[model samples]
Target: MQTSKVEIEVDTQRIMGTLASPDTGVPGVLFLHGWAGSQERDLQRAREISALGSVCLTFDMRGHAETLSQQRYVTRGDNLNDALAAYDALAAHPSIDPNSIGVIGSSYGGYLAAILTSLRPVRWLALRVPALYRDADWDVPKFSLDRKDLAEYRSSIVSANDNKALDVSRRFRGDVLIVSSENDDLVPHAAIASYRSAFINARSLTSRIISGADHALSTPESQKAYDSLLLGWFREMILGAR
Candidate 1:
């Protein structure tokens, strides 16, 4: 497998990313990081999936990582645009099967990924601690978002809870996987249940709770388990590995 850095422009903002792919054509997977994470955080998963005969694209949102300069300039809507643009660019890769694109997102990324699947064509979906999903319960700091942006985020969340993401996901009859930690303090079981209820017509929805993991899955054993579960889900659902 080989890896390379990439950047795609969504209007003025640049979405920075790392792309990994085998030496042949294969499925495509995109990785989205948590609220304060960059594309590099997902290198391990991208490498593992690429080695399994798939191409992976992991990128930083407008306000994080290599693109930190844009932090104060972007909003939740911009984040959605960045994700959609990333998928459009990734799907066009010569080594990727456009129709077989899957996505894995942690925390903020997971929430965005779920929303993306509702509006886009995603073959498989895997979410980890998908955070701030209920916009009604979330608030962007005044330093991070203006009143207008906050209104938009809250509105999006209301849409999400009203069956926008989940209902839109009904168009995708592929597999879905939701992973949560047993002792997560930030995202409770109720949040997980809400996400599950969103996938009303999924072909399969597999939910797993890490026994001793925290919201971050900090323990070595917990991290290992989380990694294995993600790799396995992509291997079978996206890569078709036996």
Candidate 2:
């Protein structure tokens, strides 16, 4: 396998990424890490996937890890922009087969992946515990005084609901696989229900809940399970004999 650092221009900002490809030709898989995560944490997964005849591109989201940004988690739209920019970067890679692209996102990254699938049709999507909800249900942290700041948060909530995976399910023309934990604390069970409802309607989705797993699913056993499930799902959806 070979690895290289890459950068892509997104609007005025430049996003950093790492590309891992095997010596022989392979399909392309883009892995988006959670908030505060870097490609380093996903190197193991990338290597595993690359060994399975797929190139893996892992990147730091804007304002996270190596891709530093001025803005924090100001709004959902900000995250959407980052995801789209990453997608564009992956799509433009010279060695990647544009039509065989797939995405795997975890936690916050999962939410972005779900939204991106609706915006851009891909071969497959593997979302690990994606969040889907409106403002009324979400526990948006409050640490602002000015009305404009409060308004931005509220507007962000509204925008999130309007652009939810449920509402955009019909637009996702590819197969989807969702992996969630029964004991997740950060994301409520209701969010999983919402995702299921939407995916069920789409009729091109598969899902699994790891017993006793937490939000991060970081336990050694849980990580192994997740890695196996992700690998199988991607192989079936993107590289299998169809």
Worst-scoring 10-residue span by lDDT in model 1: 134-143
- lDDT per model, in order? 0.77, 0.70
Give per-residue CA lDDT, model 1, range 124-191, as digits (tens). Answer: 88989875433432234313534454333433323333654445554557789999999887667766
Clashing pairs in 2: none
User: Please, what are the lDDT tens digits per residue for candidate 2 over residues 14-119?
Assistant: 7788888887634678887876667777888888888877778888777677545543433455656777887887777677777788888887787778777777
Clash number for each model = 0, 0
Model 2, position 112, has a per-residue lDDT of: 75
- Point to the candidate with the largest TM-score: 1
